[model samples]
Every structure is written in structure tokens, then in C-alpha cells.
Target: MTAPVAKLLLKVFTYRQLAVGGGFLAGFGYVYCGIGFALSALPGYIILEDHFQDQFPKALSASSLFNFIGIAVLPPLLQYLKTLFGSREAFILFGAVTWHMIPAGFGLRDAVPRGGCIDRPSVSKRHAKTKRDLKFVNKYLSFCSCLFYHKNYAILVVTEFLSSLIYISWALFLVSLGTSAGLREESAVILSTAAGVGSFLGTALAIGLFHFQKMNAYTSCAVPLLVNGIGLVGLTFARDFNSLLSLTLLTGFCLGVNISGMIGIIPSLVCRYHFQQAVVINYFIDGIAYQFGGLISGAIRDLYGSTLYVYGFAALLSFVALPWILIWACNKDPNRECEPDLS
Candidate 1:
């Protein structure tokens, strides 16, 4: 529902005579788009978990592959449009393209539980009125409590938050970072697209590893994060376009494997009843981390006049999560670790 409105907003007021005001309107439109994406994606993951069962990893990998394909394609496509048509026309065309998601979204069906729904105790009229009044607050508290119900889950949440914070900060600034290193705008864009291509390839690799090697989810996620962090730190030494492109490709590949593992790990980390909650909470953390990441990275860039430090900070945070990942992986009887305490 909000998809067309969000696109229409971009089409109407993105860069007209409104100037700065138009920028604000575009920002507002992006907020709507973000909300729509979160709403759609969270449910989609839950649906995949419920329906795909053992095949969820492949399903998710395919989804990630397509996602990066768009990431790989869109920038160059937009650049081509801007080259031929004017900038305004490019944005307008882009907005028109986004409207397709509305129809695509219509095809999604609600997930049916593999074993059917579990019944919960019903409240009587006397207690219902009071419970209804505090429902929102109570639900919020319940969700928070569930986050730490198991040690592995708690670790996953923290790791996810840090990962989101680190990755989002650098990912958003990749183009600017390339430009800062003396690459032309077109070259920088190509550099960004290389990351997407790398991600697509990496996800494909993960799918193969999942089937053939029977890779451990924790190891898959943790190892890539470790590699990506080292790669980002090494990125500071990159001087030429090729060097920067190579490092970005490596980091993007790690990012794809790490994310595929992260999403696939959720089912193993929590019970079926909490799957939706886990997805919601994970994305909620992502949204919060994204806002903080932008502010932190921008502040460092503004204060120091360098994007290198931004990647440096991201690298630092990425390393900080490694210990927790190691701890989670080393823990004994991992499958039994997710079971809720009933005594």
C-alpha cells in the first residue's frame, strides 16, 4: 500500500524548485520505503522458515542472490538513464520501476504453521479489559524478555546489532570512500557494483557449501565476519581503483555469506513460536543500528575529513563481535541450547 505512495513522493518533489525542501521530501519518501521493506521482508523470512523447512537455506541463498543482482544492476542502470535522459527523468523512471513491488507483494500468502497453530489460554471478561489496556506495553516487555531466553540467542542478537552497525556504516559510504581515494565518479560507481557482483557470487558459493560441505552456520557467519574485518582494515592501504575494488569485492563477498548464515541460523536459535518475534527483533535492531551507524560515520567524516576512519571504526566494531561468535560456536550441545527452560 505504501509502496506507490512512497514512489509517487519521490517522483513529485525529489528535486524540483523546492531545493532543500525537496531533499527533505525525498528523505521522507525513503523512510516510507524503508518501513515498507522491513514490513515485507520480515514476513517473507518467516514464511520461508515455515514453508521451506530443510530447504530454507537454499531458498534464502536464492533470495540473497537476486537481491544482490538488483544491487549490482541498479546503479549502472540508473547511471545509464542519467547519461541519456536528465537526472530528473532518471529518478522519475526509477520511481515508476519501484511501483512493480506493489503487485509483486500481492502474491505473498500468509505462512501456515508446519504443525498447525498452538492454542493459547483465553482470558475471561474480568481480566480481558485490564489486559487489553496494557497489551502493547506487556507485549513489548514479553518480546524483550524472549531475546535473552537462551544464551546463544542473546549472543546472536548482540552480534547482529554490531554487524549491522559496522556493515551499514561502510556500505553507505563506499562510493564516497572511492571518490576520496581519487577515483572518478563513474569508476567509483563501478567499484560499488563490483561489491554487488561479489555478493552474488558469494551467495552462490554459500549455497554450494551448504549442500556439499554441510557447513556450520555459526562458523560460516563468524569466519566471513572475521575475514571482512581484516579485509576492511587492509582497505586503508589501498591507493588505486583496482586495489579499492578488490578489497570491496572481498568485503562484499564476506557480507553475503555472513548474512545468509545469519538468517539461516535464526531457526536453529529459537523455537517455532518465537520465529516471527526473532525476525522482528533482529530487523528492529538493524534499523536502530543503521541510524546510529550513519550518524557515527558522518560525524567522523565531518570532523576528520576522511572516510578511511569510517571504515576503520567499522572494522573495529566487526572485530568486537568475533569473540562472541567464537563463544557461541564453541558452546556444547548447541541444538539443545535453544530449548526454553520449563522448570
Candidate 2:
């Protein structure tokens, strides 16, 4: 009787998690899908960039913005959505895809100029069962990585750990570079714009080049990190701040390409359909990445007393990320199929 009761408790715990995690994922996925749906418009990013800048006092630090992303924004968004539409993750996913395609179709037809307002179609029903529909069409956004299981996910996650470290280090270095080079605040703003443009173009190129390639996600990620490392190294030799900014444009753009490519690895890199759990696992690792990156970058900046050396240090650390990149990008994991949740 005790054995049976213990098993019963274990089963209850699992079901409880299914209720909570699944519900959390659903609400979060919904808002995310809604945002994605609207952003399918090409002009959406520019509009957002401007809108965000308009809300601030002027050129607040990027770190501060990230703090907002972590603290104020993401938590509330997750909670509110979970409450408002917890049971309706599938519907949210559908709405997101619909919004994405509708705007895209209009753009193709030249029916509306990019960014023109099209009325949003209303949600026709709201009598949702208030529970996660795990089998909902949201699987289209599921992580489907071949590497995420077996030993490969371990390898790839390790590689991302190192690479993300260097990636963030470079971002931190840029502010110091701007101030030390005596570039006006306005010039720094312009440099950011240039970097954004370059990043967008680079990602576009990756998409075009890898359009038909298998495991393009992995290849796409590796190519950009290699390029970004090279670019950051070159930044050390930049003659002036403007020159530094110019060099950084190349690096930033290359990084932009890799960022999405890295994210695209989620399901394929994780072992199963539990992609959200896998990704949340990464978020845990990434916390250390940010904390340590900032601590080390700041420590070196103070010790070396040179922006050039600080940049060089960041570039060198990027090398540690290389082994992971080489292995994951080059190796084929035999494309194992994920077993469905049978229960």
C-alpha cells in the first residue's frame, strides 16, 4: 500500500508540472507569437527601434535596457499572458501565424505599403477550457533539433556558453570604446544604427545562402561567430573612435546573423519535444555568462587602462567558443526522431 501511494504521489507531481509548465509555455508562446505576427512586416523593427528610443531619456545604457528585459518586462509579460490566455496557447499560436502571413500577403500583393495598418481580425471564441492543449498546432514552433539529445546537445550548449560569453563581452566593450575615443554621444548613436543595418543585412545574406541547405541552422551559426571573432580582433587596430565604430559595424552585423541562427538550434539541439525546458536550462547558463562577462570585462578594462587591450581580451576569449562551434557545425548527429509523448 505504501509503494502504491508513493507511485501515486510521483504521478501527481508529474501531472502538476504538466499543468504549470505547459500553461506557462502556452501563455508565453502566445504573446511571443503575437509579437512575431506583427513583426512580419519589414518596417516593424524600425518602428520599434524608434518607439523604444522615444520612451527613454536619451541613449540610456544598453545594460540598463537588458535589466529591464530581465526584471520588469519579461516576468510581467509571462505572468499576465499566462493568466489571460493560459488555456489558449494554440489559439495564440494560430493568431500569430495568421498575423504574420496576412501582413506578408499584403506586402506581396502591394495591397498596402509596408507598415500600413490592416485591421486585426478578432478572436472569434474565448470559451477556452483554461488548460494547456499540449497537442495544439503550436508544434510548428517546437524545437526539432537533431543534436539536442544524445551527447551533441551537451557539446553545442558548451559551445554556445563560450561564444555567448565573448559575444556579450564585445557589446560591453563598445560603450567604453565610445567614451575613450571621445566620440560624441550622437556619434555613438549613429554607430549603433550602422551596426543594426549591418546586422540585418548579414542575417539576410545567411537566409539567402542557406535557403536549401540541411542543418543550415548549425552552419549559419558557426559562420558568423568565426567572422565576428575576426572582426573584433580587427577592431583593436582602428585608428579613431569612428574607425572603431566602423569596424564594430562589421562585427555587430556578423553577430546579428549568428544570434537567430543560434536560437534556431533549440529543438534540433535539444533531445526532445521538451524544448522549452531545454531553453530555460540555457537561460540558467546564460545568467552566469552575463555575470561573469561583465565582471571580467570590467576588471580587465580597469587593469589594462586601454580600450584596445580590453577589446583584444574579448576577441581572444571568443576563441574558447571555437571548439564547440567546429564540432557541432561539422558533425552530423544521424538525425534521430523524437518519440512522441505517449501518455
Candidate 3:
């Protein structure tokens, strides 16, 4: 709902020239976009996981395919719009593009109604609170409590937080890094397109691997992330277009795999009842980490006068997250197949 509004806000704040504190306003708009994403994505992910459990990975990959395609295609198209129209008009057009999501939202019908013959209580009714019920400082205590119910979930969130902190910076700064390395603005845009193509290929690869390969969740996530870190570090040494393009493809491919694995594994970490809570909590933390990462990256660029250091720092974080995933995989119970959800 707020997605199109964010774009409209961007259009307004950026008209003629950037208004004072435009950067802050732009960030605020992105926050709404993030919330909008959470609202839509949570249901889509839940629906896919619940209905297509056997082929969830491929289904998720298929769903994400168009996202990568948009990433690959939008930059060049938007640049053309900026050249033909103006920044303000380009934003207006993009805001119109975002409006399509409203109709898409209408198509999301329930996979199975809760009460037909079983006479189940409504979700709100089931969880209804009384004045006597224990309360916390906020309404999110129940969701937050789910994090500690399983050690795997706790580790997953930490790994996710650390990885996301670095990943968001990579996506936001990739173009800046390209321009800093003496590429033209158009070439930098192409570099972003290359990354998107790489991500698309990576998603295709993941779909194949999930269909044919028998890798566990930990291996699926850790390997791609570790490679992703190396790819980021490789970017520091890429002085030419071809070098940067190749490395960006590798990095994006790894990112695609890592992202798919990250979300797909939630079903394994938490039980069916708490799945929605887990998803909400994961993305909420992600929203915060993304903003924090951007600020940190911006500061590093300001201090060192180079995006190379920013890329290196992001790589270091990937390395840091690798160990946690490995430790969790090693200590995972051999006898028990899955953890029981909190009742």
C-alpha cells in the first residue's frame, strides 16, 4: 500500500532540485517500501512454503526470478527515462510502476480457509488477551520470544543480521564503486545490470541444485555466502570493466543462492504455528540492519575516500558469519530430525 506512495514522495522531494534533508526523506520513503515489502512477502513466502513444501526452493526461486529480471532491466530503462523526461518525471513513472502491486495484492487468496467443518477459532480469537494476561512493554514480545525457543533460530537470525548488514551496502554502493574506479556513468549502470543478470543465473542454478542436489540448509547457505565474500574482495582489485563485470556476476550469483537459502530454511528452524512470526521478525531486523549498514558504509567511504575498503569490510563480515553457520551445523542433533515448536 505504501510502496507507490514512497515513490511519489521521492518524486516530490526530488523535484527541480533536491530539497533540504532530501536524503533523510528518501530514507524515510524507503522505510515504508520495506514495510510494504514485509507485508506482501510474508504471505507469499508462507503460501509457497505451506502449499508446496516439497518444491519450496524451486517455487521460491521461480517467484524471485522476475525480481532479478527487474533489477537487471530497470536501471537502463530508468536511466533512459531520466534522460528523456526528467528526474521528477522518471520518479513519477516509476511510482506508477509500483502501483501495479496493488492489483497483484488482490490476487492473493487464501490457500485454505481456516474454518469449513472443523470450526477453528479465528487467529485473533485464538490469541486474544485478557486484562489478566501478562504484558510486556510492547506487542512484539511474543514474536521476539520465538527467537530464543530454538538455538538454530537464534543462530540463524544472528547470521542473517550480520550477512544482511553487509549485503545491503553491497547492493546500494555497487554503482558508486564502479564510478569510483573510473567507469562512466552508463558503464556503471551496465555493471549493475550485469550483477542482476548474474543473480538471475544464480537463482536458476539454485532451482536446479534444489531439484537435483541433496545439500542441507546449512551447507546451502554457508557455501554461497563464503563465496560471496570472496567475490566482494575480488571487486577491490577489478580495475577494468570486464574484470568488474565478471566479479559482479559471481558476487550476485552467490547472493542469489544465499538469499534463497536464508528464507527457505525458516520452515526447518521453526514450526508451522510460529512461521509467520519468524518471518516478520527476520525482516524487521533486516530493515534496521540495512539502514545501519548503509550509514556505516557511507561513513567508511567518507573516511577512507574509497569504496574498496567498504567492499573489504563487507567481505570480512561474510567471513565472520561463516563460522556461526558451521558451528551450528556441526552441533546439530543427529538423532532428532526437527525441533518441536513452542506450545
lDDT leader: 1
Would you list the clashing residue pairs of candidate 3? Answer: none
For model 2, the superposed segments whose C-alpha errors exceed 4 Å read 1-148, 214-218, 340-343
| Per-residue accuracy of model 2 over 1-343 as CA lDDT, tens digit each | 4557646667667867756865776668655754553345333322332344332111112212232233223323444565677837744643453554665545543222234332333211211221134334234433432223335666766766766777677766665576667776545445555555565555555444434333353455566777777888888776576677678778866765565455444544543334444555555556567667777877887898887776787677666677677776577865333333311
RMSD in angstroms between candidate 3 and the native structure over all alpha carbons: 7.5
Lowest summed lDDT over 10 consecutive residues: which window, candidate 3?
A: 334-343
lDDT of 1 by residue, 1-343 (tens): 7667656667776645446765687689778888988877877777887778787777888888988898888988998899999899999999898777777678887776576443443323433553465466456667554454446777788888888887787688888888888988888888779889888888887887766645564556678888899989988779898889999999989888877777666767766656667788888998999988888889998999998999998889878888888887886644322212110
Q: Please provide, for model 3 over 42-149, each residue's C-alpha lDDT reduced to its tens digit, 9 standing for 90 to 100.
A: 787778776786677678878888889998999989989999999999988987898777888888766653323323355334334421142451244655655644
Tell me the lDDT of model 1 at 15: 46
TM-score of each: 0.81, 0.53, 0.81
lDDT of 1: 0.77
User: What C-alpha lDDT values do all the predictions have?
Assistant: 0.77, 0.54, 0.76
Model 1 vs. true fold: TM: 0.81
